[model samples]
Target: MTHITVDLPETVFSALRKTPDEFAQEMRVAAAIKWYELGQISQSKAAEIAGLSRAEFINALFRYQVSPCQYTEAELARELSDAD
Candidate 1:
């Protein structure tokens, strides 16, 4: 695993009510979620990046108000119609 350091304003921690470690974990999860939402990474890869299981990542997606499935409205509609 690679280690990276990020410096942030002290106010950021206080504003989010998160300790540095907590903030780091949240950052990982957030990045993974955004990448997954963007279709830049698979769910398994995103979960690995977030240090979470696939199920946990799905839960995080819901928590962040992001869809777990990477499908557009048009694609979903076409899929539904095809199922008929």
Candidate 2:
């Protein structure tokens, strides 16, 4: 994995009350959530990017108010019909 360094104001960390490592982890989770919401990545990929387990990522989706499933109403109905 390529590492990129981000320089932020000391006050930013103080204001957020998080250590640099903690902030970095939060950033990763935020990025993963955004990518998942945008339909740019699968849940597993998002979890990997966030350094979280699949179940953790699903919980994060709920926390972030993002839909876990990508299916539309019509697609969901079609799938349900097929399952029967």
Best by lDDT: 1
CA error at residue 9 for candidate 1, angstroms:
1.2
- The local distance difference test score of each candidate is 0.96, 0.92
User: How do the residues 1-84 of candidate 1 rate in per-residue lDDT, one tens digit apiece?
Assistant: 799989899999999999989999999999999999999999999999999999999999999999998999999999999999
Worst 10 residues of 2 by lDDT: 6-15
For candidate 1, what is the TM-score?
Answer: 0.88
Off by over 4 Å in 2: none
Give candidate 1 regions above 4 Å deviation: 77-84
Error of 1 at 31 (Å): 0.6
TM-score of each model, in listed order: 0.88, 0.84
Lowest-scoring 10 consecutive residues by lDDT in candidate 1? 1-10
lDDT of 2 by residue, 1-84 (tens): 889898888887778999989999989999999998888999999999999999999998898899899888999999999999
